[model samples]
Target chain A: MKGAEIFVQSLLREGVDTIFGHPGGAILPINDALYDSPIRHILTRHEQGAVHMAEGYARATGRPGVVLVTSGPGGTNVVTGLTNAFMDSTPIVVFTGQVPTPVIGNDAFQEADIVGITRSCTKHNYLVKDVRDLARIIKEAFYIARTGRPGPVLVDIPKDVSMSECEFVYPESVHLRGYKPTIVGHAGQIRRAAEMIAQAQRPVIYAGGGVIHAGASEELRTLAELTVIPVTCTLMGLGGFPGVHELWLGMLGMHGTVAANMAMNDADLVIAIGARFDDRVTGNLEEFCVGAKFIHIDIDPSSIGKNVRVDLPIVGDAKHCLQRLLQELRSIDKDWKAAHADWLAQIAAWQAKYPLRYHQEPEGELLPQFVCEQIYEVTQGEAIITTEVGQHQMWAAQYYHFMRPRQFITSGGLGTMGFGFPAAIGAQVAYPDALVIDIAGDGSFQMTMQELATAVQYDLPVIVAILNNHSLGMVRQWQQFFYGGRYADSSLEVSPDYVKLAEAFGAVGLRATRPEEVRPVLEKAIRLRRPTVIDFVVKTDENVFPMIPAGGSIKDMLLA
Target chain B: MPTANDEIQRHIFGLLVENKVGVLGRITGLFSARGFNIDCLSVAETEDPTVSRITLVTAGDSRILEQVQKQLNKLIDVIKVMDLSEEPHIARELVLIKVNAGAETREEVFRIASIFRGKIVDVTPKTYTLEVTGDEDKIRAVINLLKPLGIREMVRTGTIAIARGQRVL
Candidate 1:
């Protein structure tokens, strides 16, 4: 068997049904091998789009996303996607073609050291030198990408190695000597955490994307309900628990709701499950949640006490820890609802105070928040929404009350601008019947608008709600509040007619300039069931409120 | 009392990383990219064929050092990192020093080497080469003494350390 055939066979053995990629000179053999294979290949317009699509698929499905691209610029373009996956803990395996072995170090055309470039970002990367080791290396790449705090991995195959011939055998499993991630929490620590929970009068459950990755949403829901604690999710953890529950305090962070931030500040016993206390969420780290004894549970040991030291640290997967914790709480069999009525009432009262608000635009001018609400209404709160970074992402997170895990996808860590549309394409590929929407900003959507062709070619009905504010809305909002309204280089005057651009790409296009036109335009486009874009000319200076000034404490939230 | 200056002490970190290509590049690139200075670094494949051990010496204040620890822990290639600065540990560095000594001074060079427990590894008409292994202070003291004997050239394999007693990396 040839090396390329062996690679295809190994992918089949790993149950890879789909792949997102772009081709170049060095990867011709692999592309040739893919020509007759049963696997579906999504040929994205750019390498970055390919990788982000794979990320979207992985985040939405809890499966490892696969990407294949050619050498040099192909490999470098995927670096941003790799960094984003590393930060968000999405499992993606990227196979980049390298220059033939003979010229790997000679600075040959179409050649670059991708392994070196992605060394800091990837969980583990391999450069296959021997055809005999190719199958095993591929298996290892998949295994490392999907296990133990999931993340991105890369396998760089030199062109010569792919063209070389050898017998193929895919390894059943991998045993990495230096790679052991602690999965189950220590029994002693679980018991201690349970006891603390039982004693606390005021407790808050702060969850992150780790819960969704661990498939522990059910267990987390059980723990939160039984404990009668209000839950607030990080931006990455938006869909880990039901967003419409009575105890849901919305996302907690720099752009988090007034209620969530106030609740976090007032809590006495903070039960942080699967969420790292990142600086964005934990405003003024030293003063964050003062006097709270934390019960930190996470799969990664380094995240246990890396930021805020906890009273009880449980190093284990969220599902396993939550299961054991549920049992511990069951042994007591006591009612917690009666234990913290005042606390819940206090949180509810705060939730009533300025809970994610925006003013009605006079003369029917459009607002981004209103657009998100209309999307929520049209989709009946069930669309698998992916978002690019900035104000639009926050509005979608705030407006759409996600009720299940894997329903909302966004670049939380790296916060890449053009991430949404590609990710939405990936999600659409995963769930063909589900409504997948990319809530994007004009500034961000233009970054990767080339992917519209990919969507049209594949007959995907993915929707792009381009909140065309004619500028970078988030930066402009920051300038208004923080920088004395000296909006420098942030304003991007509307030049491209997005609706016309969508039509040029053989997709349906719509526009809604007035507030009343918003819902009807969304309704009409979503009904078309093909690739569609709704260019919404929104108010340029509409700010996302409940802002915690950088380096400010949670209690110091500014609500407008 | 220790001043603010002492807070920025040199910290020795023991990292167990995958024995893969470009692993060292990731470690060094991180320091250089983040504007952190690496005082010294030494790497070698450990007993396990699939893993490597790296000893990195960096100087930073506590805040900066904490940031380094957090950022390093985020990398996938870096399997484990243990800070050995606050613990009792054993550290050693090996240096090959060539001295510009003739027959008359060669005897004196060998005498000085013997006093420092250094072995004479090479001999030439113009120079006598010596091999010495010790901790940082010990290595620096030997180098200082060898300067008087007309040092020609010298190179050091940076420090490697392990925690003392039952503590393991």
Candidate 2:
């Protein structure tokens, strides 16, 4: 069998049914093999779009997303996507075409040192020098990508190697001597953590994206309920705990709710499950949870004390740790509910006093928050929400109440603009019948607007709700607060009509200029069950409030 | 030993890694990417042909050093990382120094090299090439003593360390 045939077989062996990629001259052999294979390939408009789509597919389903692209420019374009996935710990395997093995270092046409280029941004990468190593490399790439903390891995295959002949034998298992992930928590550490939790007067369960990645939402919810502890999620962890639960504290970060931030500030113990203390969550590290003892549980050992010091560190899978913790807590005879009543009441008081709020008059211009609320209502909080990075993303997080894990898929760590539309398309590909919506900002949407053709071509019924404010709302908001209202280059005064663009791409387009029209347009888009773009002309100066300035303590939140 | 203050101290990290192309690049790339400085680095294949040993020297506060160790361990190509500085360890570095020693300075250079237990590797009428192996401090002292004798050319291998006990890195 040829090396390209072996590559296809290895993917099949790994249970990869769909791939997101683009074609070019260097990858012609692999493309030829793909033509005869059963694996479905979603050809993206650009290499970046392909990788983002793979991320969306991987996030929606708990499988490693896969991508294939050509050499040089194709390889360079996916670097941002690889970095984005790496930062978020998304599992994606990217295969880039390389110049023939003989000309690898000679700088042949469309050649690149992609493996070296992506060394830091990827979890691991490989340059297959021989056809004999192709199968094993693919196996290792997938293993490295989906295991442990889960991150993007790349495999650059030379063009000649793919064209060369090799015997196809897929490995049954991968044995990486240097790569071993601790799946189960240490028994003694789990016991100590349980004791700490039981003894604390005020405790908050801080969850992050790792919970969703580990499929530990059920375990997390059980532990929280059994201990009667309040739960707060990071932006990436929005749906890990049910949004409508009484114990749920809206996301705790820069734009976090007052109750969640205050609770974090006052807690005596913080049980951080699969959550890193990112700077956005813990502003001014000196003042962040200084009074609290921390118990950090994560699969990545390096992430435990990377940012903030912790009292106890449990290195293992979040699900296994949570399971053991719940068992240990159950063995103890403590009335957690009665002991934490005062703390719960205090949290309730904070929540009641200050909620996530925005103003909209009876006939005022459409607000982005209002549009988000309408999306939530129309989809009944069931849509898979992907967002580009900006004010609209924050609004969606504030307004759309996610009921389950994997429902709120957005670029959290890298905060990549132009991520949502392609990601939504990927999610739609994974679940054809489900409503996958991209709540995008105009500035971010324009970054990857060309993917509209991909969506239309695939007939993916994904809705792009563009919060069309004339300026970059988030940057403008920061400038207003810090730079004495100097907007500078943050304005998008001249922009394309999103509706016309959608129509030109053979997709439906709708416009909602007023608050009343927002719901109707969303309902119509949902009814159409096709690729549709809804242009929501929102308030130009609208800002995401309840924001603690960058590096500011939680006490310094600007509520108005 | 407990640190009296959070002063920056030199640390030696011994790492066993897969002897593959780009593995070294990955390790060095990590340090550069994280804004950490590498004071000295030496790598060579170990007894196991498939594996290589790397001795890296860096200086930082304890907290930052701890992070560096963890980050190094996180790399996929690295099999194991040992902080040789934290344990009783033997470290050595080889230095070859060529001194401009005519008849007048030759005797003094020979005495200095003998005092430092260095060997005369090469000699000419005007130059004496001496080879020395010792810890970083001894090498620094020898270089300092030979500076006034008009050193012509010098090359030094970075430090390589191993734990003194039966434990292997």
Candidate 3:
């Protein structure tokens, strides 16, 4: 059998049902092999779109997303997506085609050193020089991508290797001597953590994307309820705990709620489960949680003390560690609710005093917050929400009450614009009947608007809800406060009519200019049951409040 | 006895890694990407053909040093990382120095080389190439003594370290 045939066979063995990619000259052999295979291929408008779609698929399904692109430009286009996945710890395997082996160094047409280019951004990468190593390399790539701290991996295959014939032998299991992940927590550390939790008078649970990645939401919820600890999530951590739970403190970061930030500031102990203390979350590291003793639980040992020092660090899978922690906590005969009564009351007071608020008159210009609220209302908080990076993204996080893991997928770490549309398309492909909405900004939507064609071609019923503010809202907000309001190059005044663009792509388009029209347009779009774009003309200068200035203490927030 | 986290110190590390293509690049790339300073680095194939040993010298505060070790271990190509500086370890580096040892300076240079137990690898009408091996301090001392004699050129291998006891890395 041919090496390309072996590649397909290996993917089948890995249980890859769908792949996202764009074909080019160097990958012709693999594309030909794919013609006879049963694997579904969603041809994206660009390689970057393909990779983002793969990430969406991976995040939604808890499986590694797959991408196959050709050489040079195709390979380079996926670099942004790879970095995004690497930063967010998304599992994606990208296969880029190389020029024939003989002309690899001679710079033949469309040849690229993609492996070298993506070395720093990818978790791991390979350049397969021989057909014999093709099967094994694919197996290893998939293994490295989906295990440990999940991340993006790339495998570059020379065109000749795909053409060369070989006997296909898919390995049963991968054995990487250098790669071993600790899945079980140390017994002694778990016991110590439990004791610390029981002894603390005021404690807060800070969760991040790692909780969702490890599928530890149920364990985290059980532990939180058992101890009556207030749970706060990062932007990437939304939906890891029920948004409507009594102890939920919204998100805890730059634009976090007043209750969450205050709880973090005043707590005596902080239980960080599968969360990295990112700079966005821990403003002014010198002053962040200065009075709190920390217990950090994560699968990656390196992430434990990378930012803030921790008293106890548990290195294991979040699910396994939380299970052991629950067992240890259950063995104790303490009344956690009684002990934490005062602390809970203090948090409740804070929440009641300064809740998430925005003003909307009876007949005022449509607000982005109002649009997000209507989206939540129309979907009944059940829609899978993806967002581009900006003020609109924060509004969605604030207004949409996500109640399950993998429901709120957004670019948190990398903050890549134009990530939502493709990601929503990927999620829609995974669950065709489910409602997947991309709450996008006008500027961000324009970044990858070409993916509309891809959605139409596949008939994916995904909604692109564009908050058409006619400016890069986040940068504008920053300039308004810090840069003397010099909005240079931040205005998207010469933007295309999104409705026309959607119609050109053979999808339905709707417009909601007034606040009252927001719900009706969303309702109509959902009823269309196909690719629909809603142009929500919103307040141009709206800013996300309760924000701590970069490098400022969380206690000092600009709340208006 | 540096007690504070801000006290910067030099540390020698021994790493066992896979003997595969781009393994060295991966290690060095990680160092550069993470902004960890590498004082010196050396690598060679070990007794096991499938594995290679790397000796890296770096200077950082306690926190930075801990992060360096942890980050190095996180790489897929690195098998194990040992901080040789934490234990009783022997470290050596080889240096080849060519000195302009014409008539008057020749005897002094030769005497200095002899005191350091260095071998005269090459000799010409006006130059002598001396080979020396020692720890960093000894290498620095020898170089300092030979500096006044108009040293022509020099090259030195980075440090390689191993534990003194039965423990192996």
Candidate 4:
């Protein structure tokens, strides 16, 4: 059998039902092999679109999404998308076709050092030179991409190797000489963490993307309730904790709420589970947790102290670690209340004081914040909301209350400008019944605005709310706030009208500039049940409130 | 003296593989299967056309090193592998650091960038993008120096290395 056939068969063993990709010359053999295979291949218009779609599929379905493209430009095109998925910890297996192995150094047509270009972005990658290793390599790639702290993995297959024939025996398990990720927790460390958690009065649980990947949300919720500790989630950790729950303090980061930050600052003990303390979360490293005892639990040992320092570190899967901690915490001290009544009241006061306010008109323009709240209300916080990175992303993260895990997907780590639209399409494909919306800024919407065709072609009903400010709002805001209002190249002065652009892509489009027009158009678009872009021309110079100025302390927030 | 659970002494590696197309894919695939993280990796071709040496610094045990050697050898185009942790190696990484600077802070950034011998890549009225290349420690030192100046954006191309020996990968 051919090497590509062996690779396909290995994917079958792993129960992968579908792959999204754009075909190319170097990967023709794999395409040929896929012809008769059980795996379904969804042809994307752009290689980057295919990758984003795969990422969306992975994020929504909790399965490793697969993509295949030709080498060179095809491979390079998927690099940014892979980097996006990598930063968000999405499990994606990307296969790129390469020039024939013998012609590798000849500088053949359409050949680029794809693997070299993508080394930093991928968790791991491989090139199957010999047919004998094809099945093993594919199996290993899927395993690495889906297990533990999941991320994108690339497999570069040479055209010659794909065509070469060899006996295929799919390995039952992978035995790599250099890699062994720890799965079990250290008993001693778990005991110490439990002891610390039991003793603390003002304990806070910091959840992250790891909680979702380990399928430990239930355990996390149980632990949080059993100990009466409040919970705060990272941007990627949005759906892990129910946003409306009394103990939930919402997503905490650069744009996190005052209550969440205050709660975090005042905590005596922080139980960090599956969450790495990104710089956005801990504004000042030294001031992050002055007197708090940190008990960090993560599967990847490297991540323990890579960012924030930990007092007692327990290395294991979040689920396993939580289970162990629960067992060790049987002797609970009921009389121990951290006596943070005053602090909790202060948090409540802060929440009420700066509750994501926007000028609302009863009969005027619908505020972007109000639109998000309406969507949240209509969808009942169940729909998945993906956003292109910018003002709209921050607004959605701030105003929208996501209640389920893997519901609010955005370009967090890489902060890619145009990730929302394609990602929403991908997410909708993964969850056909759930409502999916791409909350995008006017400038960021145009970056991948071409994907409207893909949505219309597939008949995917995705509502895209374009927060049109007629400029790169975030940069312009930065310019306004920091650069003495010197707006340089931050305006989208020249671009096709978005309503017309939507028509060009064969999708319904609506324009709502005022508050009264906002709900009517949005309600209509939602009812139309087809892909539509609601262009809402928001007020210019309307900065995202509660701004944490660059290098500005949390105390320096410009709350208006 | 190496117990099964010693603080896995991190090893920095510098690999010179064939500049051929799939060389990186093969080498990375090997390290990935063993779950070894290539913390800092940079790859560029030397004067030679038939070869491109990849500098990768990774943490692993003796078993991992052996596996890296064996699996790397299994690839057809991987010409050679050099563990820089064992030899005198020259390691470097480049970073494009953009800092939010006003009139007062701009001078501080310029001074630090000058001290580090970094070139100013892009300059706006409120921001200065500096491009600096050096070892991990140097990069960290530069970042530390600029911290007081307010780093607005930063991108590091991890670590790239070449062994200082008569032989080349």
Give lDDT: candidate 1, residue B87. Answer: 92
Candidate 4, RMSD to the unseen true structure: 14.1
* Candidate 3 per-residue C-alpha lDDT over A1-560 given as tens digits, one digit per residue, 9 for 90 to 100: 89889999999999999999999998989988998899999999999999999999998998999999999999999999999999999999999999998998898888878988899999999999999999999999999999999999999998999999988888888988889999999999999999999999999999999999999999989999999999999999999999999989999889999999999999999999888999999999988998999999999989988888889999999999999999999999998889999999999999999999999876988889989999999999999999999999999999999999999989999999999999999999888999999999999999998999999999999999999999999999999999999998899989999899899999999999998898889999999899999999999998998899999986679997
Residue B75, model 2: Cα distance from true site in angstroms: 1.2
Q: What is the lDDT of residue A71 in candidate 4?
A: 90
TM-score of 1: 0.93
Per-residue C-alpha lDDT of model 4 across residues A1-560, encoded as one tens digit per residue: 88888878888998988888888899998998999988878777788888888888888889999999999889999999999987788999999999999998689998998877787688777777888888888888988888767889999999989888999898889865345556788999888887887777677889998998888888888887777678889888888888888778876667777777767888889889888887777876767767688999887765676556578988788898888888887665553335545545666787787676787777754567776777677677777899998888888988888777788888888888888888898888887766899999988887777778788877889889888878898899899988999999999888678788888888988898776676678778878889998888876667777776765556776776
Judge candidate 4 against the unseen true structure and give its global Cα lDDT, from 0 to 1: 0.80
TM-score winner between candidates 1 and 2: 2
Instruction: Give lDDT for model 3.
Output: 0.94
Candidate 3 DockQ, CA atoms:
0.55
- Return the DockQ of model 2: 0.54
- Candidate 4: docking tier: incorrect
Candidate 4 chain B, poorest ten consecutive residues by summed lDDT: B1-10
